[model samples]
Target: MQQQTLVNFQNFIIATRDSGYKSTASALAELVDNSIEAGATKVEILINKVQEQGVEQYEVLIIDNGKAMSEDELNLALQFGGSSRFNSRNQLGRYGMGLPNSSLSQCRRVEVVTWKKKGEFLSNYLDVDEVIDKSLTRLPKPKKSTNCVFSIQSKSGTIVLWKKCDRLSFKYLKSLIKHVQFELGRVFRYSIWRGVEIRICGETIRPFDPLFIGEGVNLKGGLPYGEELHYQVKIPNNEKKTSVVKVRFVELPVQEWAKLPNEEKRKSQITKCAGATILRANREIDYGWFFMGDKRKENYDDWWRCEVSFEPELDEVFGVTHTKQEIKETEFMSSILVPDIEQTARALNNRVRLKFIDLKRIQPQVFSKQQLERNDMYLPPVKKNDGLVKKNNGSLKIKGLEYEIVTKELKRDVFFDVEEVDNCIVLTVNTAHIFYEKIFKALHSRRINNIAD
Candidate 1:
């Protein structure tokens, strides 16, 4: 290949910083994702300050106890779009641009050191600054490992050290370190929570589970259930394939209703019904799509559950732009996925309505037959006189009103034929039992006495 023209390195760095991640901290998160996906049981990251010739420099070191790459694997791992995943069903990585692109986009130089089982340590470095300054399309061989700062002694693992970190221009190195620590914690929190321990500067990172613990509002009944569903569709190549989608639903505890904040509760309701997660393969693409309207915040609490997954083949249909911020819809996707997804959205919306119904204390008469048939089930109606009346035999009725008592009893049983004429309550009850006949006979006697009076 012919030598490329020298590029303006400063302008490229400025553009990358302004557009992709505001700071070096956020950029490092992409690299952490790669480590998590590499099946690392533990990851250690170190940030150290450096000073040379009276000028300040910073270095970021990352080490992982994961399956190390072979010589060929090491070379491919540094190349953009060179992925090892071909047909792995549960693979979290697909694009393969995550490692090198994410690294080069942030730092001046990227260095990798890996140790494979039954082999010597292998190391490589990409000095983007040198390449861009000299205008070389192909990078020269990395310098020998004699000067490498990060190394691994494990029989199988890897370590990456980033040097010449002039790209991260923080007011202070401490501030930059703090930012990196926070971003890594958030991005890899789930993996850390799952026992994949990761430490930054001797402090272990913990996942921030949005579900508040010991907050009376957590759903107590049971853990949510989930299942994956697939559908067949034709793509641009006229090849039929299965599209994967996962669905999860959880029931929140009843006590959580009262303690939850209004804004938090509102978000929870939407999340419970339609906290849709969009993912490419296994990695979550983004939290909400059509399910969460544009104006909503990402504060869905524990009361809600969401479904998260993606169909890898539909990446193009999603209008996945280069930045991956927004999703655009194509005609094919609009017709197929949109309808199915919208139906799921509506199902969650209906579920929210049900939660609201429970909150408002609605009448049980409106519930379905199966729901109403439960022995322990009771949908208490709106209290009469604002609950001044007492509950009698599982029914709320006004007190000191004999006529009202009779009317309530008549209405309590679903078999009663009742209608209101003017201001009075009117109803009829019929039974073939002899006790009922005797009760009416006594009423007849009392009617005669009243007529005599």
Candidate 2:
């Protein structure tokens, strides 16, 4: 006899596994976010290729030195949308559909073990097979775990083990590690800058600043295009209230880098990356063509970059979905950002074009970097245990993120302020600036929802 349930539990688990994550790294990032929230200074992702029952596959273990959970909390972690953290997300586009959503998205089973002290450990798990077979009705009760497969020496922390990973994007271990390496470094660059050490199979990850303006970077000499542009936007549902949206642009060095070997350029990720970076509180939600009006992207445009940063308060204004993978276009938001962004993008593109044309005039000389440019360009690419830079005698020095924009309310009358905070040149835009009045009032005057002239 079939029980009349509101929704099929077994079918739901099978369908939820395909939750459309952009990549394995993105899904893994949700778990990392949990660690960071729990005050984890170090996070380790251990993946092992093994044979189970004559079938070869891989198992993933993410261990973090974060605050441990109680038995009640361990049970909450496995239930779908059971944790309060997901419901009340303070960070924009982060952890809303957390833990279970992300874990099961790539694996058939997830086991979580947490501990408050070394002696006592609480463990629980959710298995797709168990649910489908109707052997599991509710989440299994937490039990004492003495010997965890992935345990840290610290006094407390949490471990999330992913088994039967049948839906991982990169089946090959090497490719998956590389993808995780780049993704973690870029997405959590700000956190790493603060002091988080993320390791995959023991190799520490380096923060990959997309701006490419920092020192020790392969391609250098990127400078702020101009004074950072500031705009105040009206908060939805409250016409009288408003929030701030800031825009900044970067001018990459095209004349100097254009002379590098094609292979070297590709390695540095400078060949064809062109578009705006959307940042909402630290995490880079979306990166691609944004607010360029009707201008078609060209190869020359790759030389420059743009960052559109906004508060989570403006998530509704920007149309940020829970997945945080994308930001939809809104008629109200586009009008405020398009003109300046489009104009600056064109100007930077023209600058790169002109620089390339001028470089042809100078006599070529073998620069210092020429000898070391291609250490082993011909000898196949390194896949395993590789960080951002795999050469230069396996050493890469980084100070921190080179550029950032921070917003604050000021008591004094000022449009913007610039100061150095934690090694990066921080641009503190005054959201309370009177400029917002001129912009917001103008926007409210012209409503665009209804048609007809």
| Candidate topping TM-score | 2
Over all chains combined, what TM-score does candidate 1 have? 0.58
Clash count, candidate 2:
0
The clash numbers for all candidates, in the given order, read 3, 0
**lDDT (Cα) of model 1:** 0.52
Candidate 2, 91-173: lDDT as tens digits: 53344467888898888899998988877888989999999999998998899966665546888999999999888878788
RMSD of 1: 14.2
Q: What lDDT does candidate 1 reach at residue 116?
A: 54
Q: Ten-residue segment with the worst summed lDDT in candidate 2?
A: 388-397
**Cα displacement (Å) at residue 195, model 2:** 0.8
Give residue 156's error in model 1 in angstroms: 2.4
Worst 10 residues of 1 by lDDT: 396-405
TM-score of each: 0.58, 0.76
lDDT of 1 at 416: 41
- The best candidate by lDDT is 2
